[model samples]
Target chain A: MPLVDSVLAQYFEDALKRADAMAPDYALLWQSLQAATYGGKRLRPALVLSAYAGLGGPDPAEAAEVAAAFELLHTALVLHDDVIDRDFKRRGVPNLAGAYRSRAAGRGVPLEEAAHRGQSAAVIAGDLALTGAYRLVAASDLPGELRLRLLEELDAAVFASAGGEQLDVEFSLPGRRPSLQEVLQMSRLKTAVYSFEAPLRAGALLAGAAGREVEAVGTAGRYIGTAYQLVDDLLGMFGDEELTGKSNVGDLAEGKCTPLIAYARLCPEWQELAGLLGGTPSAAEVRRARNLLEECGARGYVEDLVECYAARARAVLAEAALPAALLAELDGLLERAVQRSR
Target chain B: MPLVDSVLAQYFEDALKRADAMAPDYALLWQSLQAATYGGKRLRPALVLSAYAGLGGPDPAEAAEVAAAFELLHTALVLHDDVIDRDFKRRGVPNLAGAYRSRAAGRGVPLEEAAHRGQSAAVIAGDLALTGAYRLVAASDLPGELRLRLLEELDAAVFASAGGEQLDVEFSLPGRRPSLQEVLQMSRLKTAVYSFEAPLRAGALLAGAAGREVEAVGTAGRYIGTAYQLVDDLLGMFGDEELTGKSNVGDLAEGKCTPLIAYARLCPEWQELAGLLGGTPSAAEVRRARNLLEECGARGYVEDLVECYAARARAVLAEAALPAALLAELDGLLERAVQRSR
Candidate 1:
């Protein structure tokens, strides 16, 4: 585990202790939250730490704190996103929300009531994580000025993410099909900025990097994040469940409007079948839909777009003044983002 | 309106303009949030301003920003609370969450789907507000140290409130009724501190009030807030709709284990009727419930608790070194908290 991960581990241990000491009501919630922080790429926080070190900043401690903050923010957003989407699984396992829902059922709460309790717990759990993210930064030993600026960055991400979330939800409504352009924009706003731009820029800001350097990192993150989303869109449809750790057919069943689906809608070969996207198709129907998507060249189109973003990321690296170590790391990230099977 | 209220009004006007410029997806949400801010007594924000002035803070601009922040926090929590409680109305009107739900229904969306969308919108809307509240303070003109310390205060409130919210949900579960001691702690954590302690301390901190003065304001806020919740419990059961602007039977129908109900559970006169507290009683049953409550003297017990809190607030006022102007404003606030028919 990295520095930020260790810090996060210690943070949760102490936090859960305090919360439990305060009231036993939140014990399960705290435990679920702990489980949530256990795995993942830790990508966002890594970006924070990398950016801070890359920019020649003196405070690894502050960078670690900020990194943990990003992770918490991501956790809260993902938790809430699952609730809105009614998803019960993440990374091939029951997520924090799912765990609560399952617990309620295991305890013999009726289905609807159990679901309600699960959602309630998840909502409150997410609320705790969201505030905890801000609390991490607020309690950091960093000078007040540094912490304030970082908070401003954090807030900007939250604001932009809200707009993105609104767009995502609005576009996903039944019988509401958004344009390809809108999907791309929403993708950038909803995922790319927060995942890529926020962590990278936050790191740079902590390092006291120049405005231009921070802007360059943002551009790099945008391209990289967009590429990553494109790949995710691919994996959701074509990847194996064993590798992706997801049902893979969920995007189709949930009627998620992804770049692949949006582009497929524009293709004459797939346009006729596009209406079946969210009809909760059977397993056989999903396979047929997947085959059609691939045969119609929609997958190719998305792959090409992913390449475009990857190339743009390279272009940014060529021009940015970031450290060599940072550039090498970003290159590796880009490779993983665009080429990962999962 | 007071200076803080006007400032809040202007702030929203500008914020709405900016949000509209960014995206139309949030237009309805922003409008409803603006509506929610209107027509209230502006109690929490008023406390912020009062505490700031009482602490001899010269910058009304900073005070106004903090006041608006408190109002935003309150609005967000209330919106989410309604979702958790499944209430659709607030202040005799369709609140932000209710507005979305109603609009969806009006558009002929199916009942279940529309309700889902409404809840989804409310969740996101509240998230936006919560993040927006932090943004306000982060973007304030206060010095870094002051803002940092203020954020510590803010984070503490959010942390405590989250625990309080969890306690509230757990206690309200179908078969579990909280003890009177737990109820009082919940009331203090959920209402008193955030509504009273937080804003008051925030303002005092911004004004650079001495530690003792800040502590004094916290004590004053606690007593006042406790009294306010007690009155709220009373009004929920006994107050009229025309004055209280709510379906007073809701507290009983929802089986809210308020202090009154807790105490009444021990009273022999109400033991048989106590089981009906959360049974979604009919209009006549509600009437009978009310009369029984009064007859058993449960109302008097709650009234006595309210009086005790009021006296404590008065005692804090007598000892606190707050300015005379602030003391007068607090006196008026205390009167409203305990004496208002609503």
Candidate 2:
């Protein structure tokens, strides 16, 4: 196995053990936590570790705990995000709310009451996961100043992401279409910085990287994160459900105003597409909307944007004063992130 | 002004400035923040600074930022708590939700949408306050280890408080009334520890106090906190509205399962009170319920509990090895905290 993979496996084992020990009686909370944590692609942790390696840091084992911390935080966000978005499934399985609702029904509660209870439980579970992330970082063997800095970065990312979520929720309302630039800015703050830049910067900071090296890693992270989110937006619209393990049409169903949707709005044929985009559109309407997106060249436009970001990511990586081997690995990850089917 | 008050006033000014600079465009967010912070009695920050001084530590100014941090965190909790309770008013003024609801109406939005937008904004505002608390602590001049410890304490308090809140919410539902002991435990975790112990301990830790001294302060804090909560219960049931700034009969009307209510549940003669307190009751019904509480000796029972905790607080203060002058002030503060009308 690769170094990052080996370290991540051990990290997950330890994290799961710690989570289990935290709540012995809350069996459902434990199970939901395991489901959220165990199946992730580990992109955030890999970014952190890669940044550390790029900064001349040795021993992937040393970065494993921090990696675990970032992953725990991400999982916590996902669980809460699903609840906030009213998502019923993730990775083709019942999400936390769905699982808890089912459990409550088995105990003979009314449906609405069961779902309310599930939401309440999910909120606390997310809080516990968030606290666990901090606990992991606090309990790490890292130096105190470094730990504090890492925590500060984590805190900033959380706040920014939360603000982004607020904007995303607001954009769902009528007459509130944000400008495309605003959308990209929100995406960068909400997804790119936390999902990519902050974690990588945190890892590099932990490895004592300073000045231009740190700045370069952050730049690389931003490019890669933008590309990753662009791909995610594309997949949300057009990916196969069997492969992506998502609703495939979920974002459209939710009326999410992604970059592709925003571009579609700018086209001359937007009036037709807009009718099919928002509210409860039929399956046929959704198919037509997807077809409209392709007809208007939105899909191609977004794909081109993703490629541009991916190329920018490569250029940034090339400019970073890091080891050739680490640079190559990071370049590969960026390409794979933007090109992956699922 | 007393040393603790002087320090807190200065700290509050600086912290507010920092918060303003962080996000200038979010004016309503800042106003809600100022309302929550400035409306508080400054008891928590007083406890912290006083504890630092009680430990014979000089330079109380050094603890100012952290004192402000605790106050900010406490305010954030209050904002969220008000929302969770669907409270329209707090501290005799419109709450964040109420204010935002009015603003949305002024903007010509529909009622339901406005209310939801208000709730969403309040959530984001509370989150911002929560994040601001950590930022203050992290950027303080305190030593890194001390700062980390303080942050950890605050985080743990938040988790415990959230857990307690969950329990409180659950207890409000039919068929889920926990035992009186469990209620007290929840109260201690939710209100006492964070509101009293953590702040004091944070101060002591920052002032270079030893473990034993910190523990002793915690003991004193627990006693004071419990007594304070007991008094709060008393105020909720029987205090005059003008003095308490809350409906004297509000708890009874809302079917709040507080300590007094729990004690009433155990008494056969108080069965009438239970029926009245089962759900939303009329103002007249609330008045009659209050009379029943007094008549059935539930009020007297709570009074006795308050006295016991207050005496325990005084005894703990006497036992703590601290400067005599600081001890005297803390004792006076504890007495006033329980004895004050509002």
**TM-scores for the candidates:** 0.93, 0.87
Give the best candidate by TM-score.
1
- Cα lDDT of model 2 by residue, A111-133, tens digit: 87666556555655665566566
Lowest summed-lDDT stretch of 10 residues in model 1 chain A? A270-279
The candidate 2 chain B region of ten consecutive residues with least summed lDDT is B19-28
For model 2, residues B93-207, the per-residue Cα lDDT tens digits are: 7777777777766767688667656655665566566666666676566766776788777775776676666566556655665777767866876788889889888878877
Tell me how each candidate scores on DockQ against the true complex.
Answer: 0.50, 0.24
After TM-score superposition, the amount by which residue A238's alpha carbon in candidate 2 deviates from its true location, in angstroms, is 1.9
The positional error of residue A38 in candidate 2, measured at the CA in angstroms, is 4.0
Instruction: Give candidate 2 regions above 4 Å deviation.
Output: A1-35, A92-94, A97-117, A135-141, B1-35, B101-110, B269-274
lDDT leader: 1
Candidate 1 residues B80-154, lDDT tens each? 777777767777776666777777777677777777777777777778777767767766778777887887777
Write one digit per residue (lDDT tens) for candidate 1, span A37-93.
765678899888888888887868768888998898888888788878877778778
